[model samples]
Target chain A: MAYQFDFAPVLQHSDLLLTGAAFTLALTAVGAVLGIGLGIVGALCRAWKISPFDRLFGLYVEVIRNTPFLVQLFFIFFGLPSLGVKMTEWHAAVLAMVINLGAYSTEIIRAGIQATPRGQIEAASSLALTRLQTFRHVVLRPALTRVWPALVSQVIIVMLGSSVCSQIAAEELTFAANFIQSRNFRAFETYFVTTAMYFVMALLIRQLLMRLGQRFIVGRPR
Target chain B: MSLVKITGLHKHFGANHVLKGIDLEVAQGDVVALIGRSGSGKSTLLRTINGLETIDKGELVVDGAALHDGKGDLRALRQKVGMVFQQFNLFPHLTAGQNVMLAPTVVKSTSKREAEDIAKEMLLKVGLSDKFNSFPDQLSGGQQQRVAIARALAMKPKVLLCDEITSALDPELVNEVLAVVRQLASEGMTLIMVTHEMRFARDVGNKLIFMHQGRIHESGDPKTVFAAPQTPELAGFIGAVQEA
Candidate 1:
């Protein structure tokens, strides 16, 4: 018997798939921006020894890194409401993604910061650049450039992981695939198309990030 | 008048005493050459003047400004002094022009156009005017060091410290950097350079201070100091360099 593949059944309900893709993009874009911001702040606090902030962020990183991402998503989406912090499913999903990416990027960025040469810092301070100015202009950008590839990979991982949001009825790509499969009983066809979409998105994201790195991170033309 | 003064200065790392009870004065327009064996604390002494190294016990005053306690608020003092390292520590991410312009724009609040203008002028002075758009890695070792000099001079500091500036460069490239330093010295920049260039130090510097065992072994006019050594340590140092 031939294992006849069919994407026509999945392609017929294209609106649902497009809407789900849009939602995936929205969640990942917003989450990535906020998460990168959080990561930089967290990394700086830890790298510069901002006392309570360093210790607190270190604890956050350890807790998030050791646990399962699914568990973390559930805790934010399901557990927080019991503590009087209630949010909609979509809000919970975005918040969970941000927290997850933020922890991973904190360690990534901090390693970059630490690897910055001592002489560079000395030169900046010798020129009387304030500590904040030194970190912003001299330290942070080059550090990000050094570790950008790792950062991009982590972001894509988070994007693919968005599939888990279906568990909370977030109506992302996976949810649309499941909805189509349930409606038409085309499990293999629906999932195959969805997986291919994710692969394409991952490539698009890598290109976007590389362009960003060229424009902002490593400003040297060479 | 002396622009920099250090009295009874002492610095130690753990049980290792790096600078021991040193007293020195550098006047305006004076070029002081610090010459000694590698472990003689000459570099540590130069660094202490700029607050780059901690002084365990001493009084340091630069341009009549007091040394702030525990590295506090050296900003005012540092603004008056510029340092160039041996490795030519140009910020790799920035172009030659941006590297020179960074301190003035950020620390002194010079506008971008003005900073760029100054960077151009300084780079031109070091013969790197054409390399304003080049990255550090794109330039040769000597060109990079020249850019480093330009970066320091962009601050228009009253005093300049060169820590083995040309010691890292090739023999063929050394003169290009040394020429810039020579011009700075001739134009009356107060320079304190720790160098192994015996001939350049002898010919260029007005005063020579020989350090030995974390102490000033001898000090005098360069011609007299090298011609007539006051200590066997100074003689040995000069002999070793001559052989190398």
Candidate 2:
């Protein structure tokens, strides 16, 4: 017996895949924004070594980076509810993705921050700029420019990795693919289409981020 | 009272003591020159005055404030003392005018327009009125150092410190920067300079201090220090420079 190709069932439920992709993109977008916020704070915590808080933040980054994202998702979705912090599957997935991305971005941004020259910091100090002013004008701007390419690639990877959220029934693209496959018994066709959709989404996001980076950062060499 | 005073200053970077019990004083509006061979602690002494280098043991009083005793406000102390580095450490991202304007805007809380006006005036004084919009990389090294000087002066600091301000420039460019310093001294800007340029030291300095092995070997009027240095170390150091 040979496998029969079927397009009718898969095409009929195209709306389901589209909705799933919308959810996936939403999750990635929200997660990325939250992740970048957390990453900047974490990088500053590690960079400034601002007392006990810095060491505590370092521990948080280490644990997040070393563990698998799947396990982290399970901890947020399953483990947290038992501790009286109940969350929806979507919330859990988004939170988990944000935490994972934050850890990686912290290292990337910290490297950028450290790469700034000591002379620059001294000059800022001689100007008598307050700590906050120096960091905003001298350290953060240059650091962000230096690590922008790395940050973009990390965001794209997060977008692709969001497929893993389907394991928790988050109703994203991968979850929709599973549903379509089961209904039509057309596993290969459904998966193939879904994979192509993800590729296109990732490519679009990468291009957009690259354009943003070029416009804001590429020309401003400090 | 001395405008700036250092008494029993001591600093060590690990086992190498960079400043060993340095004592000096500068009256207001005085132009003092520190002359020494490399590694003789001339630069270290300058840095210590501004608290850029922490002292292991000492007292540094600037304009009646104790900088090393931990009793003074360091930020306020720095506002009173402006320093120009050998590398002309201007913020590369900012224009020359912006570089000069930054301290006033941020530290003194001057209005941006007022800061710009002051920056323009300082740039003009440094003979760089045409390079206000120029970045550090856009200017020649001599021009960059002049901007660095203007950047320091924009704070209206009572004291100006120069650490080999012309050492990194080309021979042709050195005179242009030295001229700016000379003009500042002529206007009574209260200057302390570390320099290898013996002729400029002799001409512009009211007082001269010679350092050898992390200590001031001799100090006096420019004529007395340069013509007949009292210490053997000072004489030997000057002899080596002359021979070179």
* TM-score of the A-chain for all models: 0.97, 0.94
Candidate 1 — which residues are off by over 4 angstroms? A2-4, B68-72
* Per-model fnat list: 0.76, 0.42
Per-model TM-score versus the true fold: 0.98, 0.92
Interface Cα RMSD for candidate 1? 0.8
Q: Which residue pairs show backbone clashes in model 1?
A: none
How many pairs collide in each candidate, listed in order? 0, 0
lDDT of 1 by residue, B1-244 (tens): 7899888888998999998899999999999999998899999998877778877887888886667333445888788889999988889899999999999999999999999999999999999899999988899999999999999999999899999999889999999899999999999999999998989998999999999999999999999988989788788888888898
lDDT of 2: 0.87
B-chain TM-scores per prediction: 0.97, 0.96
Positional deviation of B19 in candidate 1, in angstroms?
Answer: 0.9
